[model samples]
Each structure stands twice: as structure tokens, then as C-alpha cells.
Target: MSLFTRLATSYFFYFAILGLISPYLSVFLDGKGFTSVELGEIFAILTATKIVAPSLWAILADKTGQKLLIIRLGALLALLSFIVLFWLNSYWPISFCLALFSLFWTAILPQLEVFTLTSVRHSSKIYARIRLWGSLGFIVLAVVAGQVMEYYAPGNLLNSEANLFTNAFVWMGTVILLCLLISTMVIKPQRIVNKPQQQALAITGKLLDLRFIIFFMAGVLLQISFGPYYGFFALFLRDLAYPGVAVGLLISLGVVAEILIFIFASSFFKAFTLKAILIVSLAATALRWFIVALYAESIWLLALTQLIHAASFALFHSASMIFISEHFTRCQQSRGQAVYLGGVYGVGGAIGAYIAGVLWLDGLGASTTFLTASVSAFIAALLMLFWPKTIKKPSQ
Candidate 1:
């Protein structure tokens, strides 16, 4: 197959596994008899690994000029390490497995994103088109996995025997990650033109510039607002008495909206400034959280909230990717992507997941937790709105 096809396929499988993990992992842990605090801590541990893993591999890939090799190794090792989950039944052991699993798993994506940007020569439209495949993969697997879990799990999913269905999710995720490795292997490495290396001090200075700092700070808050949904949306729906199929559809609905936005992301980039997209996405995210918090029992309102995901995730993610590609120098591309992933998705996500867990366990409940998420998203929007413009003109 062609390089573009391989790249798209790699995304497809990689996100397929993520689709399983993001929406279902909490349900799996809950079924495994984990207390809410323990669940929060474990998810925090999983996300925290991303803090070091992506940047470490990114630095290695940059210095060694082995981007594809690093991608392959990460995918392979993550799959191998994740296999230990099938037998381990306790919190500490599973937490250990998750830490290793996420360390390598997180290493793959940031480097792959850098590689993709390099290959496409910063074509925003093409990148979005390729990324939409990941959304498709996510939709298919999320619906199917939900059905699979429902089939294998006994009633209420709390029984000792019922929890075994969660193992199916682990196995499915392992196979998908392995498939991603194979896709990476088949991808012909592009000839990356190495830019002249800048001094470490200069690189650090640019990375710590005012604009860069504010942009990442906004990104961190945005991801933080996603904590409750990512860590416990499935459980939330289940508690509200929604069937597994409906829960899967609710989760898939957001990704479905993501797919639509990605198909036209280039047009958005052309019509609006990056700041506009970020503001709109953050604002919509805030609104979405409030809607979810207040009207979760109203399936129609929840579906409407899912549609806002088009703005919250797809547009936001596309804007951020382009922003990173344009702002950072060629030599700093991998590290720039790593910083975004590690800071926003890693540190931000860890804090969000853990706090959401605590809030759900100790506070009024899920609704109150989601209300807090809304406030966080609104603050992120304000940050983006006031950020100093560093680019003179739009790149699209």
C-alpha cells in the first residue's frame, strides 16, 4: 500500500484501541471491584506515564533521527507490556501494567504526528483527511466493543464472573495495538531533511516564549475539563439506567461529530484564525459539559451535547496541530508535539481523571463533577481569547 494509506491505517488501529480504553476502561475497573478513589489513582497513574514517555521518545527520535524506528519500538513494547493485564486481578498489579502500557503507548502518537506533518509538508487539509480515519475506527470499535461487553458481562457487571468480560477489552486493545505496529513496519520511512541544530538554550528560550506558554496553558485547561467524560462517562450513563448499547452510541456520537468536522477542517482553518477555533471549541466544550451535567437523563439533550464535540475535539485538535507545526522550527517539531501531548493530555489528563474520581466519590455526584468541568472549560476559553497573537497571518 501507499505511504498515505499506511499512515491512515496506522491511525485507524491506534485509535481503535484508544476507543476501547477511553470509554470502557473505567467500567472495567469498576467491575473489577475498585473503589472510586483507587480507580482515580490508577487512571492518574496511567495518564501520568504519558508525561515522561512522549517527550523521552521524541528527544531520542530527534537526536538519533530514528522517528519510524522509535514508533515501531514503542508500539511493540506497549503491546507486549499490556498483555500482563489478562492475568493480574488486583489494583497494584494492574496499575503497574497500566503504567508500562501507557508509557510506550503514549510514545507512539506524538512522534507519528510529527512524522505526518513532515510527510504532508504542513497541508492542514490532508492531515485532517487522514485523521478522520481514526475517527471512523473509533466509531466502529466503540459500538462493537460495547456490544461485546454487554454480551459477555453478566447482569449489573459487578459479579466476579461478570467482570471477566473486561478481559475481552484488554485482549482486543492488545491486538489492535499490535496491528498498529505492523502498519508502522510496513510504512516506508520518509527522508526527513534534518535542519541545522540550534543551541539548547535558544531552543529552550523559544519553547518558553510568552505565546507558547499561554497556548499550552490553555490546552492543559481544555483537557482538564475532559476528565469526567473520559474517566467515567460510561459509568455515568450506566448509573442513569442507559443500556450498554446506548452508552456506546453516546460515546460514539461525539466521535461521529469529530469525523464530520475533520472532513472540513481545512475550510475552517482558511475562514477563521486559530484563536477563533480555539475559543469556539473551548466555549462549546464548556456548554457541552453544562448540558451533560444538567440533562444527562434526557437522551436527546445528551445527543445534542455530543454534536458539540465537533467543535470541542475535532476543531480544537486540528487547530492545535497546525499551531504546533507552524510555530515550532523544523528541528524542534518532534519535541514541540511531545510537549503538547505530555503537558495537555498527560499532565492535564492525569489531574482531571484523578480529581473527577475524587469528586464523584466524595462530592454530591457525577452531575456536580461535570459542573466543575464546565467551569474549567470556560476558563480555558478566556485564556485563549486573551492570548497575544504571535502570527501575523493565518497559515491556511
Candidate 2:
């Protein structure tokens, strides 16, 4: 198969695991008798590992010219770490296992993103086409997992909680193993192209640029605002008396919208600048969160708000990737992507999740937490307005 085909396959499998895990893991952890605070701490730990692991691993891969090797190793470690989770029940042991899996799991995707962009350097318009497959995979796995949980385990009642979660862990571990094997098989052997000495220095210097700082800051804020939704949306629904299947369908609705946006993103980019796309996404996110905060009781309104996930997440992400691909040169690409993921999604998400935990514990509840997120997104939208219209091209 061709290189893009291989990357697409890897994306599909990688995101399938994400689809299965993201919507249900918090619910699973909650089933293990973890309180909101405990679950938040665990999720924060998992995300915090990303702040360090991806960059550290990327540096090693860049220096050793072994990006594929590192990805395979990370995937293998992620698979093994889940096994430890199966046998342990206490907070500390479970936290340690989650940390280990996250360390490896976090390292794989950014590197693969770098690989895909490098391979399709000039044809970047098709990036979403490849990535949308991941979204599709996510939709399928999430819906199926929800159905399975409902059929087998029914409610979140504690009587059969162990059985439900063990089954989830087994499924997650199996997918990771399969993804690693596929990743290993399809990765072409290629020499790591290093940046020229002077260029490397210049790239480091660019980190201090005001525009770059502002852009990164905005990215961080965006993820931070998403913290409550990622860490506790399911629990919130359950607390509101929504059934498991309804929660899953609500989550699936968002991804379906995301998939539609991704399918048409290239055209949208053609008509609008990356900054404009991002601005719209942030605005939509702001509105979406407010609706969730106030109208979560209404199923129709809740589902309507989820449809905005297209503008809020899919558009923003695609625009960000395009920006990174355009702004960074070949050698700096991997680390650039890592910084985006680490600084934005990793550190930012950890902070958001932690704060949401505190709010939930303090009885501020989901509505208030989502209101805070909406405010943050509004601020993020205003911040994006000040971004420079053009980014400096990486030095040759």
C-alpha cells in the first residue's frame, strides 16, 4: 500500500480506541468507587503525563532518527500497562497503571501526525480526509461500546461494576495491541531529516515570538475550557437521570457533526483564513457550552448543542493542524506538533479537569462548570482576534 493509505489505516485504528475509551473511561472509573475528586485527579494525571512524555519521546526519536521505532515501543507499553490495570483495584495502583499507559499512549499520535504531514507536504488539503476516518472510527466504536455496556451491564449500579470495567479494559488493551502491530507493519523505513544547525537555532528563537506565544496561549485556554466536558459529561448526564444509551447517543451526535465538518473543511479553508475558522469555532463553542449549562434538561436542545461540535472541535482542530503545517519547516514539525498537543491539550486539559473536579465537589455542579467553560471560550474567541494575520515561514 501507499504511504497515505498506511497513515489512514493507522489513524482509523488509533482513533477507534479513542472513541471507545474517551466517552466511557470516566464512567468506568466512577464505577470503581472513585468520587468526582478522585476521578478528576486520575484524569489529570493521565493528561499531565502528556505534557512531558510526548516532547521527551519526540526528542529521542528526532535525535535517533527512530520515530517509528518509538511509536511502536509506546504502543507496546500502552498495551502492557492496561494488563496491570486488570489486576489492581486500589487508587494508587490504578493511578500508576493509568499514568504508565498514558505516558506511552500520549507519545504515539503527535509523532504520527508529523509523519503524515511530512509525507503529504504539498497536499495538505487532504489531511482532514485522512483524519476524518479517525472520527468515523470513533463514532462506530463509541456507539458499539455504549450498546455493549447497556446490554451486558445495564446501569452503573455497583453490583456488577467490576465485571463491566474489566471487560472494557480487555477491549481497550486488545485494540492497542492490534494498533501497534498494524503501525509496525505499515511504517516505511525513512531517515530522520535533521534541521540545519543555524535553522535549529532560529526555530528555538521563534518560540519567543509574541504571535507564537499568543497562539499557544489561546490553544491552551481552548483545551482548558473543554476539561469539564471531557472529564465528567457522562456523569453529569447520569446525575440528570439520562440513561447510558442516551448519553452515548448524545456523544455520538457530536462526533457525527465533527465528521461532517471534517469532510468539508478543506472547502471551508479555501473560503476563509485559518484564523477566521478558529474564531468561528470558538464562538460556536461558547454558545454550545452555555446551551448545555442551561438547557441540559431538554433532550432536543442538548442534542442540538452537540451538533455544534462540528464548529467547536472539528473546525478548530483542522485549522490548527493546517496552521502548524504551514508555519513549521520539516525538521521542526514533530516538536511543533508535540508542543501544540502538550502545551494545549495536555497541560491545559489537566488544569481544566482539576478545576472542574473542585467545582463538582464543591456542589457547583455540571451547569456551573459548563458556564465557566463558555466564558473561557468567549475569552478565547476575543484573543484569537488579535492573532497576526500571517505567520513567519520557517527559515530554510
Candidate 3:
């Protein structure tokens, strides 16, 4: 296979599994009769591992120059851990399995990101093209899984022998993650020159830089704003009395727009500063969440709102990739990706999930929850305005 095909295959499967989980995890947990608080806590546990896993692995990758080794090992171990979910139905077992699985699972991506950007020589546009396939994977799995559940309507989401939906989801996720692992094995390893322990420590000054600090805070808030939508959007749709297929379609619609943005990411990057894109993305996301809170009952309006995801997620992500790339040196690449994803996404996502759980209130507080997300995003946008007009470029 060509290089793009090989890399794309991994991205496809990685996010295919994500699609199956993201929109539906709450719905699945609800079917198991878990309360909203429990769901929040579960999501938090699932996300909390992210706080440490990626950075730990990235440090090792930076120190050992074993990006591919870490990636492959992570994928293999993650798949193995997730399989234990099939045998456990209780809250603790399921929660523990998810947490352990995420610890490994979350490590794979930051390293792969380093590997990918290196492959394409840090061209954000080319990188965005490859990343969009992951989005496509998400859309495919989301729609298919939703339709499957709609047809079969499994009474239980887990630990049920005859549950077609549960069985199919687990088996398919296993196969996809397996495919991801196999894809990793085939790729040529990244040959990063091993950095000393102090090399890893060298990033501390950069991490504490004022611009980076503000940028990190804004990114964290933006990620935190995703909690309600990520944790409860599917269930929220159901609460609005929408069918399963519609729920998936609405979610997928956002990514369709994201795919388009990725296709034209270079143009946007050319047209705007990274800071501008970040601010606009955050601002637009606030509006998107507000719409979800106020006008979600209308399918047309909801579809329109989903389009904002192109700006909210895709544009911002592409810009952030370039921003982070510019902020660090060549030697700092792997650790940079890890710290941002692990620290920003990890910390922000855990808080978001927990808060979403508490505010969701079993479908009674959906609007309030989403409204809170809007305010978070809006504040994130306002914060990004203070980003230094001059960014520090990667050391040659």
C-alpha cells in the first residue's frame, strides 16, 4: 500500500471505533439503568486517564526515540484491555475496564500525530487531509451503529448474551482497533534522535511561557465546552424524541462540514492568522451550542447548527496543530502534541464530562447544560484575543 493509504487506514479505524462510542456511550449506559451522575463519573474516569497517559508515553517516545514502538504497543494493549468489557456488567467493572483501556488507548494518538506530521514535513494542510479520513470513519460508524440499534433495539447495552447491538458494537470495535494495531506494525518507525532526560525537561520553560499559558487555557476551556455535547448529545436527541438514525445523521452532518473544511484548510490558513481562526472557532462554537440549547427541536435548525462544527472543531484543530507546531522546536514535537492533548484535552475533557453529568439531570437540564457550554466557548474566544501577535517559531 501507498504511504497515504497505510496512514489513512489507521486513522480510519482509530476514529471508526471512536464514532461507535462517542455519540452512543451515554445512550448505552442509560440503557443499563445508570443515573446521570454515574454516566458523568464514568465519562470522567474514561477521560481522566488521558490526563497522564499521553504525556507519559510521549516522554518515553522523546527519550527513547521509539514513537512507532510506543504507538504499536499502546494499540495492542488498549485492544486487549477493552475486551474485558464483554464480561463485566456492573458499574465498577465497566468503569475500571474503560479507564484502563483509555490509559493505553489515549497514548497512541499523540505519538501517531508526531509520526504523521513528520511524514508530511509539518504541512498542516496535508496533515489535515489525512486527519479528515478519521472524521469520515467517525461519520460512517456513527450512522451504521445508530441504524443497527434502531432496528434491533437491544434492551441492554452490555453483558447481555442475546443483545445484538452490544455484541456487534464490541466485536466491531475490537476489529477496528485491531486493524489500527496492524496498520501500526506495517508503518516504518519514526527515527527521532534520542533526547536526554534533561531534553524532556527542556520544555518546561516553553510550557511556562506567557503566550503558551494563555493559549493552553483557551484550548482547555474550548475542550471543556465539548462535555455536554460529547457526553449527552445522543441521549439529548432521544430526549427530544428524535429517532436513532436522525441522531446519527445530525452528528455526522457536523463532520461532513468538517471534511469540507479539511479539504480547504490551506485556504483558511492562508487567509487568516492562527489566532484569528482559534478565536472565530471558539466564538462560532458558542453560537452552535446555544442553538443546540434553544432550537434543537427543529431538524433544519439543528442541521444548520451542526455545520458550525466545521469551524468549531475542524478549523480550530487544524489551526492549533500549526500553532503548537510553531510554538515548539523540532525536538519538542512529540512532547508538544502530548502535553497539549494530554493536558488540555485530558484535564478539560474530564472536567467537562463530570460537569455535564451533574448538570444533565436526566434529560431535564439539557438546555441549561448546553447553555453552559456556550458560555464556556464564548469565554475561550475572548481569552484567545490576548495571544501575542508574534509567535515563537520552532528552533532550527
List the candidate 2 regions with Cα displacement exceeding 4 Å: 152-162, 195-202, 362-364, 391-396
lDDT of 2 at 352: 89
TM-score result, candidate 3: 0.95
Please give the ranking of all candidate structures by lDDT, highest first, separated by commas. Answer: 1, 3, 2
Q: lDDT tens digits, residues 1-396, model 3?
A: 777877887888888888988888887777667899999999999998988888899878888788888989999999999788677778998899889989999888888887888888888777888999999999998998788767656533444544566666777778888888998888876555555744645788889998889889998999899999889998888778788889889899999999999899988777777888889999999999999999999999999989999999999988888877877787788888988998888999999999999999998999999999999999999999998875533221
User: Clash pairs of candidate 2?
Assistant: none
Cα lDDT tens digits for candidate 2, 1-396 = 877677777787788777766777777777677888988898898889889887888777666656677777877888888777667778999888888988988878887787766666635466777888788778877777766656555454466554675567456657656775576577786654563452243356556766677778888888888988888887788778777688778888999999888788778877777778888999899999999999999999999998999998899988788777666666676777788888899998899889888777733587889999998888999999998876432211
Candidate models: Cα lDDT each: 0.86, 0.78, 0.85
lDDT by residue (227-330, candidate 1, tens digit) is 99888888888788888888889889999999989998988887888888899999999999999999988999999999999999999999989888888888
**TM-score of every model versus the real structure:** 0.96, 0.92, 0.95
Colliding pairs, model 1: none
* True-vs-predicted CA distance for residue 228, candidate 3, Å: 0.9
Candidate closest to the true structure, highest TM-score: 1
